[model samples]
Target chain A: MVNAVTTGADAKVSVRNLEIAYGDATALSGVDLDIRENEIFGVIGPANAGKTSFLKALNRMDMFNPEMKVGGDIHFSGRNTRGLRNVYALRRRIGVVFPLPVGLPMNVYDNVALAPRLGGQRNRAELDVIVERCLRRAALWDEVKDRLDTLGSLLSGGQQQRLTIARALSQQPEVLMLDEFSIAVDPVTTMRIEDVLKQLREEMTIILVTNLVQQARRLADRTAFFLDGRCVEIGVTEDLFTGEVRDQRTRDYVEGRFG
Target chain B: MSRSSVTDFDRRNRDWYIDRLVQAVVFIGGISAIVFIIGIFVFITREGFSFIATEFDVSGFFLSQNWRPTSESNPTYGILALVAGTASVTGLAMLVAIPFSLGAAIFIAEFATGRVREVLKILVELLAAIPSVVWGFIGLSIMNPLIIEWFNVPVGLNVLNAGIILGLMAAPIMTSIAEDALKAVPDRYREAAEAMGATRWQVIAKVVLPAAKNGLLGAVLLGVGRGFGETMAVLMATGHSVNIPTSIFDSVRALTATIAAELGETAVGSPHYQALFTIGIFLFAITFVINLTADLIVRGIRNK
Candidate 1:
């Protein structure tokens, strides 16, 4: 029934009857959701729930995958993303952090500065400021400032994850989508990044996709539970854990009884 | 316990003996390569030793352009003209090959998809399989006349002709290696750069090229090696005149061509024959160094 709902002008991103398939294998079907502006929206799902496909669809990454077929309308900032002539322009406005860190085979300073450089900011002084601020916000500046010229791939796993976050932040995107950002991060660093996400929520719409239900409870204002390529329910994060969900499957999933 | 069921851990079975036999065979096969290389080196050194110890003039051998090795009154053994000819041809070949090979490689590795990629790869391998003599024949019959008509030169069998033929000869192999280097760059890097709003060209130029730099350099060096070692094509395309060419139209001779043309006519123990063997040693050493450097650079990619 939610798939039939009309779009709202207030929503930053609106998905309508979104269907994703990869070469005859359906990944997600009949999914409808609206992500509002400046809210920490969470997606909690088991593996193969099409959570990653949802993020990829928003940024138009399906262009790279010949087999991936996206069949629906997705509106970002009140404009249809599929109709845009320049997809790169649309992607620049939205940033994504993948499940695993990719350090871009460059140095630490260059890693964070890449997005801004791509945006045509050539002033060294301005770029240095942006790089330092992004790294500090990602909680990686202290460890990496002394060795900014060293290769980013040389960083440890957790440090690389934080560097990815810093790189994403440098875009100053209106929307930030992160898929399993804490998979390679230690618990202490995870908590630190969780704080960074909360601070970032005031400026951008944050979409956090994680398997950790407790993380959703901690950071998400509204959470959507996806299972078997479907969105089972979307509700207030606390309500899902408090047994106020519309579906029994949502309760079971949050309670760790079953996925 | 039954007699057949009794087990002895120390007993070597048939499979164990076969495995040991295979290990020994492979060891011999591996070491034979080094042995053969050393044997060839020793033979060449022994043949050329007499000339080097007696009448070899370092300055004249390297600097003198005259290579008259069969005059009764005054015979000389200078290779400067041959060296110039080889250097000029190889240099021009690189100029022609680098752009073509790199462009072909980028298309094959990054842009082409499915049937196009498969067909292109097969075509490139087919190009590489073409015989050097066939390439030389094309140069002599087809390119020679074309060059003379186009440039209005007195002769066409010169540096430009040999260089173009050699470049065409070397491009496919360079393209193959360069494509491998580009393919070896992880797809994750491209995805990451694309996610940051980089266009396709931007992703290649900024991320992929930098990551695959060492491998690409190795590919270029391998192409240089291929150019230097190519004998038949150079022998046919170059007019085989002994001269230090001042222009592309001037006919010249290569060291390999000189050896191939002269080794049969001269007596084995004569100074002229030994001089040709010395040139062989020089070529062997140069090619060995180039190939080793290329191999090391290619291996650097794996270490990263």
Candidate 2:
């Protein structure tokens, strides 16, 4: 779908002719995207449409899966990320949250403290501030502040999701990716987290992958509609929702037709 | 009978009977193991009761450093020296085994890829396959001379030599079990930690090892138990001096070694022979406690 679009020089993340596969089975092919800085770039796609694969590619999370293979040029903040020796540094800057509530098997405080600790922050006072700030930003401080000693895994699903977000936030990321962050979260918690994401975009670039098309309309500045391992449409969220989607499939998806 | 004539109800009833039969079979199979273990304990303790009643000095048997079973006139059977010997050998074995075993486990679980992991695993199994008697022979012939050359001790087959060989015997078991524990760690934890910029070592040290604590404990304790109960290797490797070891190089008599050396020569129904049963109880108790603790840890892991 991005075949007609030109690569934006000012984009924070630029993908060109990207193709991804696991072993011999292709997941995505001939994909291109330019994600501008400090915008909530929403990726909306059906299940198995390579939305998570795209996100995984950005931070080289594919390293964990030996079967996964990528053939593309992905430039993050103007630096090429292909075969980069320091993938951990790249991943640290591009924080990611999974589809499920995956709080670390540790206390609430340690969950948030982990990223900062990984970054070599040893001072108890500094860690406290970092943890508190991240938790507050994730809108989990009020619920978890009194029970920082409790295991994060023991929390309610919504709370754990928030704690995961808080942990991601503690990484001091330049780009924050939330992959179906509201999958198990309550509607109220979802709205709260959406609001938090809006605020977060002011400080860092946000990539929001969601099945909820309306969630994209609510929070995304720019949205890409992925279909069957291809980008079917890419435009402003408002333009995509304005009953004039460039692609018919995007209109169909946005209007609750066949995904 | 026609296939259609056999109703679904009849087939279901047949399945129910078969399932119950299988269930009963499995129940008996499981209970037999427990019954056998209990039977061994009961039979041994029955033989030991006479010794415990008359000849066994409960306190001095453990505290006193005398272990003279062969003395014709005044045969003292204080097992404190034997217990001390067992402790030193087992303790020294642990010190040698833990780092190497954990290193092997980490390498297999975290670092080695598919084929390499399998190859390393086979190597560990090969190590475990070597008999205790062969290890004892190797220590006696090859290692003892090297020790005498280096340490300049009169006899090279001292506590150090026995402990070294025992450590070698136990390392494979420890590594394999620990690796299994490490492998059992959920991938999500590593993914989360790595996403937070934690390196591979950091993920292992902070997350994988901590998450697999129970398994690691079980592995180490079971390994220690192996060292504790090993009879042939310690009997051949240690010089079997009946005294408290002042140093790692000092010759000592482990509980297993004492039993192996004296059991055949002692007359049946004699106090010395019955006292050997008491020593059996000591060995049984230590092995039982270690195994039980390991089982508890495994159960706790399963419960979690």
Candidate 3:
């Protein structure tokens, strides 16, 4: 059920019939989603709806766990992701923000510099520039520039999340995936993150996964409602939020009658 | 005003009392253990410090190659030979233990499947269970002969044999500790490295190893301490020569082996007896310094 005009419109990431299983249980069942370039896409669902699993598959993290098996077509920049056995290279093109901050135990500067340094840029000046730019983009430079040498674990929770985002940004990924980015953060910080996401969408594609429907409506250019490992509906954010609802389940869910 | 109300409140208060009891017991036990450890250290230093005056001709004792305490003409007991022998053997053992243990640790921490890792971990733990005396016996019977025959060595009991046995002994410890260190490295670090287009080997070499460098360094030093303090294996494997051995095949005596071997024959109040005690003090000092250095390195890595 692909929309005629919007189905393949400048998509940077395309997943089709994506099925993932861990032993006897299935995490995702024939899920398909298209992510457009330079757009903030939101995936809204209750817990266990495979939102994080979907984010992980985009970067081949499901393969890291030997027990989990993924069967599907994930196309990135017109190439089949499965064919690219180089997990590092694939991940470089797509970065992830875990639910928690998950900052490395290193200094903030090193945390930001790590990806670029490992990606083969050895010049100190170049790294310095990249770190500053990323931290600035993440809106963390003001608070952290003075304490770049301080261990990342010493930062406040919201600052740590921003620093993690900055660390991800230093890789210069084409698609940035945030899995419950604001779940551990306060509402004031959440608003700041939404602003950062808005600015970030101008530079790269972003996929925001959250259960907060209002948050999805606020930041996403397009939103997909997921339930039970399947997309119930996907469309332009405004249309999806305000337009006539068809499916009774979708209507009930959108109206906050049920999940 | 009802009996039910009083009963419910008492039940709530009961849980609080239980929690307080647990906390009190744990706090007292932990503090008492710590105080006991400190007291032991203080007592040892106070009792042993008299003989170990920092000004006691330590240069020759550490550097000289002589090993005779009794002579018809003149008696001398320079501990240099024993210290050097111990150093050489422990150094070689560490060299062997570091690579093998780190390799095994990395394999278990990163590459092995869950079931395989469990099996490997159990095997490592079993290795730790084998008695040091058994290792000494094995080295004496099986390994000493092999070295003598295979290498055509003049003495089967040599540094090489002792070092090999010590390395084997130290591996399980290094492997286990290093595995823990590697495991302590956050998965996010590995993820970031991978996201940067680094290969698995690269991720380990650059990110995982550096992050765990402090822990790995501590593990290695602990292994070295194990090799250094090893008494039975060295006594059985080494030929207990007083003279400094140039080659791995030449016989040598470590401080621990000397103490174990000579304590029975030497008179209690003799100079030889005091000298052995001196050697024990020296070994203790060496381990203390090594552990201290390890602690410093671990702190440095953590605070970096």
Candidate 4:
């Protein structure tokens, strides 16, 4: 049941009948979603609901694990992602931030510059500009500007979270997948990052996966509610909150009832 | 209801005795290792000192370049040449071993999975199980001639030859320890790198290797310790010449080789025998320091 108004628009990422399994256990099964271009697409679900797995699948992170088995099609910009020869190029265009912030063993400056360096932007001045722009976009420039040489791992949790955001942003991705990016961040920092995500929406598609229903409500143009590894409902964010959810479970979850 | 049968008093009594028994057993286990080490140290030192009493030429013992204990007119106790030989062979060995070992480590940690990784690990363990003398035999029969033919040297029994053998001897150990270090790096770091468009090689070179830096260093140091103390292999491969080697190709004698080669023939109470004991002290001290420092660095990294 596709919404007539939004179904055929320029979709940035399209997933069809996506099923993911790790050994004997299945993480996600029969998931379908289309993330439109330059829109903040929110994913709200409870723990173990395969929200992170979905984000991981979007970036083809399953390639790292031999045990992980993925079935069905995931397309990026009308091209089948599974068929892409250069996975790194596809990954560069689809950046992901995990639930927990992962700081590189190197310093802050190097952390942001690393992706660009991998992509062959070796000029120091150019890296410096990219790093500054990304950090500024993530609202982390002022605190870390003076300490760019400091070890990335030594930053405070909130700052580290922002740095992860900045690092992902530095890649200049087509679709930015943030999987519970604010879990480690404080409420104030979460709001700041939310502002960053809203600002980033004009340039690229945003896939914000969160446990907080209100966060999805606040930022998403269209929202998908995942339960037991299946999308229960997907509608305009306002409809999910304004007593117009297609599924009763969506209304219950959005109204702060059972997940 | 069952609480009445197994009361707190009875449980506490059983727990206390079992805990004491465990404590005593663990203490004995831990203390025995230290005691054994200390006892060995004392024994070696006593033997080394017994030699010193007759001839206390400490400077000649350490700094002298000539080692002619068998000379009829005069005997020199200079160990500089032996030390030089040991240094050259070990240095060359390390140069060969580190690259191959690190490569194996990266392969096992980042690339191989499932049955392949398991098989490789067992193969590494089997490589280590092969006796040092057997490795020496392999070097003597196979590698020595190859080296001579490859480099067109006068003799294959030189520092380079010994070094190659020692490098093989140390590679398995180096690979295992380095693999441990590389494996200790969390998956998240690798994922973060990959998600940022980093290739497999780039992720390893930049993130995983750096994260495993101290552990990798510890692995190298352990390899050095293994190379330094290796006796039978070096004894067989190195030509056992007491002269300092001018190059890796020149025939040379490691300290262990000298001790191993000369100790059995000399009269037990003689200065030569005691001097061999002195060389053992140097080997022990150097091994202890390298291993201890490596342990410290690894622990420091883990703590951080």
Find the candidate with the highest TM-score and give its number. 1
Q: Residue by residue across B115-203, what tens digits does model 3's lDDT show?
A: 89999999999998898889889888998889879998766888888888889899998999899889988887787567556778878
* Model 1, residue A132: C-alpha shift (Å): 1.3
Question: Share of real contacts kept by model 3?
Answer: 0.57
lDDT of each: 0.92, 0.89, 0.82, 0.89
TM-score of chain B of each: 0.96, 0.93, 0.84, 0.93
Error of 2 at B276 (Å): 1.1
Minimal lDDT window, size 10, model 4 chain B = B1-10
Q: For candidate 4, lDDT tens digit of each residue in B194-282?
A: 99889999999989998999999999999899988999999889988877888878888999889888998988877877888988998
Compose the digit string of candidate 1's lDDT tens values, residues B1-304: 3567546566799999999999999999999999999999999988998998998989889888889999898999999999999999999899999999999999999999999999999999999999999999998999999999999998899999999999999999999999999999999899999999999998999899999999999999999999889989999999999988899888889888899889999999899999999898888999999999999999999899
Alpha carbon deviation, residue B2, candidate 2 (Å):
7.5
TM-score of chain A of 4: 0.95
Considering the two chains of model 1, state its CAPRI-style docking category.
high
Ranking by TM-score: 1, 2, 4, 3
Query: For candidate 3, lDDT tens digit of each residue in A1-259?
Result: 2233334657888887888788878888878788999999999878888888888888888666776788978778666787675777888877778788877767899889988887888999999999999999899999989999998878999999999899889999999999998888888888988899999998899999988888988999988877787777777877767755555666566668776
Q: DockQ: which candidate is best?
A: 4
Clashing pairs in 1: none
- Candidate 1 C-alpha error for residue B18, in Å: 2.0
Residue B111 displacement in candidate 4 (angstroms): 0.4
Ten contiguous residues minimizing lDDT sum, candidate 2 chain B: B1-10
The residue ranges of model 4 lying beyond 4 angstroms of the native Cα positions read: A1-7, B1-15, B50-54, B57-59, B148-154
lDDT of 2 by residue, B164-207 (tens): 99998999999999998998888889988888778899899888
DockQ of each: 0.81, 0.69, 0.46, 0.84
lDDT per residue for candidate 2 within A187-245, as digits (tens), equals 99999999899899989999999999999999999999999889989999999988778
